[model samples]
Target chain A: MASTTEILEKILTSPPSAPQGIAYNYLVPNIRGLETMVKTLQVKGAQASGYPTPAASPQSEQSPTSTSASNSSEISLFAAATETFSQKNTNCSIAESLERCKPIMELAKQNNIRVRGYVSVALGCPYEGPDVDPHKVAEITATLLEMGCDEVSVADTTGMGTAPRTQKLLQTLKEAGILEEDLALHFHDTYGMALVNTVVGLEHGVRIFDSSVGGLGGCPYSNVATEDLIHLLHSLGCETGVDMVKMAEIGDWITKELNRPDDSRAGKATLARIKG
Target chain B: MASTTEILEKILTSPPSAPQGIAYNYLVPNIRGLETMVKTLQVKGAQASGYPTPAASPQSEQSPTSTSASNSSEISLFAAATETFSQKNTNCSIAESLERCKPIMELAKQNNIRVRGYVSVALGCPYEGPDVDPHKVAEITATLLEMGCDEVSVADTTGMGTAPRTQKLLQTLKEAGILEEDLALHFHDTYGMALVNTVVGLEHGVRIFDSSVGGLGGCPYSNVATEDLIHLLHSLGCETGVDMVKMAEIGDWITKELNRPDDSRAGKATLARIKG
Candidate 1:
């Protein structure tokens, strides 16, 4: 958490090259985090070409010439559905967390940067068990969207979501007037139901999802591996704009780099297929 | 494969104690395999409780005294949805495999035993790819059922099933006049879609599923771990009559005995929770 600013600086100075229309998102926790990101972008812009402004602006008209890596950079703010989780995760209540994000939202808006919101423990909470209220999740999601978030990702951080619960949560959100296009689903694989939950999300018309490369950045049993998710999507005839081979390659390389096992079933299968 | 008779003999000699209502099913590939089982059961019966007879008969009236373990024994016959898989797996064509199962079915019926049928590669074939026709699956299922199989388990042996494919296959089977109560689903987790496919099966009103302990007895990525399936079912408020703690303990013990890592995410999480 302490090295976030350093990591942001490193990314700004040496941004990875991606295809056109790809967004690189950073988690900006609070006002200080947003300020750090702004400063890093300013320093990087001063060093490189002038600040890429118009493309970063959500309200700006699409200009074909305003294409840069910096233009695609966005920041995310996070809130929690359960009070206990909010207190444990961000040292505040759910309402307080939303209030804290307000200034960051304003600042990001002023800087013409797109913002994403995350609702952690949206399906279930570690402290609350599997009985997380869908009504509460809907309220937080509505609040995030109202606070100027471009999209809000509801997270099953504990991976305790079943298809029925997922369906209920999505139905509740829909009843709260949330459109499927404005929402994303994030799931961990702790109980091995992430994909099943993903299927439920798809059935509810959710299109966007959050996944980890090689199932990294979570506990051993957590994380819906990016390769596995993409593989399922592709198998279902969904076009994800991802090359399976390249994604598997990256998953393999990164897991090896981290001295961790490649947790993606599709990645391993793809490697075996390509080798054959 | 050669040691199957020996394994059956061992099981007959020292059968594990299960609940009174539980059934112990064996895969009987041919008449020869059924002969071997019959002989072993006779020998064990002569040595022990004088051939527990009435319990083994599927048509026998449920007498209160007929509660022997052998009474609950059943046999499973297998056919394939694809010719290539049938040839590769059973050294026969699909028709030949079904023909071979006929005598086994007749003999089992004569011996008063229930028969289960397995339709392999029902969703997708490794050699034929993902375009396997659901109608073919339906035909094989109907044939097996007509051949006196009490239930037919359709298997995604290669784990190439997606939700849509599963739905299509189930729809075809339903259209073919197959009752949901007469079917089971067997899925390997080679592509990590087993649980999602299981959801599709559940949605189609199928209740029975086949799973392996600790995800054992298959390739590294295959076999839906029993603990994972049970955990999902329980989380969905389905009464599976399985004790989660005991299942996790067995998963741990068996995986350690095999010197293979336990592949059940839910098993690992259960252990972690109990230990913590």
Candidate 2:
């Protein structure tokens, strides 16, 4: 298996071309991960200046249409709302996890990189069941924002979230003075409540959402589908500027490459509708 | 294959025992279908009096505790908003289909049977695409009510419904002088919008919903899962008086027996959570 550094090298080396306004985000676990990313960028920058390198790598700053991975201006860091989940996932308590992210957040800031914090199991936890405390999630989100995260993504990691709980969680966050613009939602589709929960978030004025192409990373159940989310948003008259048909094609291709079942209902239906 | 009358005879002869306050409903297509059901009930009623043949079939009126199929005091009739869909589904145009239902509606009333009218493709039509007219749906619903349907079920048969369209449709019905209590909503999970659309219906004060066990009858995409709907309702603090656990088990059994994949995410998750 490739080391994290090697994987970052591969992605930073051959990032796909995205249109203007699109961003490529990577998750950095700790200070070490942040250092590795910075080191990779430095080496690429040196190569681009023609110092013992074969050719210049496509740099985002050089050309807005550069094919090279948009310099990964944004990195993500994750923490958990509950103690047990934090310990099990990161081998540390919630406070320790936050502490570990502090240096990364500071370094990213110094390097002019934006940091996105993730509050995992914000809606529900596997070890704790479906009653995760919204106050705890709000507190963690506030801490991340204080630590210089541009925004915090609240996740229903176990897909145990329901519509009412989603409303209550967002209400709690609002009461805690968290702006909806500074927050995003990441929901799994384990119980198939992701879309409904997303609707609740929209009702609370949340605009940003995280979804997986073809619902990748979904195990036991599935993750929320990118195609489905885009389709829904467009149907609601919310202009996402994302082509749902193109997303469906990408979802289909990725799931096929991974030899996994395509869990995107909208993806399959879109293709069928087009073909038919 | 059994004829429709034979099928009704089998159901009326040996029905599953249901608890009190539970109702059993069947779909009767036309006047002949209604007459067949009435005849079946007559035969079952005669047998219950013990003039000759066998032991009395358990009757709901005989004893609330009796372990027999509840007499189907209600039946459903389906129509379509779009002319093409109506012609394709029922071999008649919308007006003629409603005309055919007139005798069924009259006969059901004479037999003291409640009728549920279903407006299929109310939210959208396969031939008409996603721009189904809410006014047309409201008009059909009003006509059904005028024809003595106790309740009208508005269906997004093609699963082309979205949140904004759902809200608009409900609002149109409300403006058409339709009472929420006299309306029900039926959504398919084809695009994974069933639950979200259901939330919109609830927001519009609609309480009745139609779903299938294990998401049966789902083709191309899938039907809304009964287990998922119940789970959502219960999570929202709505007392449906339906046991989700039992529903999950039934969904599992029926899907396995049918040799089809279980399309109910909540059914699978609920059973797994219980087992784990």
Worst 10 residues of 2 chain A by lDDT: A49-58
- Reference A-B contact fraction recovered by candidate 2: 0.81
Q: Cα miss at B141, model 2 (Å)?
A: 1.5
Query: How do the residues A72-157 of candidate 2 rate in per-residue lDDT, one tens digit apiece?
Result: 45799999999999998899999999999988988898888888999998888889888999999999999999999999999998
* Prediction 2 TM-score vs. true: 0.91
**Which residue pairs in candidate 1 have backbone atoms (N, alpha carbon, C) closer than 3 angstroms, thus clashing?**
B55-B71, B58-B112
**Model 2: how far residue A12 lies from native, Å:** 1.7
Model 1 C-alpha lDDT per residue in residues B170-269, reported as the tens digit of each score: 9999999999999999998888889888888998999999999999976433799999999989978899989999999999999998899898989988
Per prediction, the TM-score for chain B is 0.89, 0.90
Candidate 1 ranges beyond 4 A from true positions = A48-71, A219-221, B19-22, B47-71, B219-221
DockQ of each: 0.65, 0.72
Q: After superposition, how far is residue B137 of candidate 2 from its true place, in Å?
A: 1.6
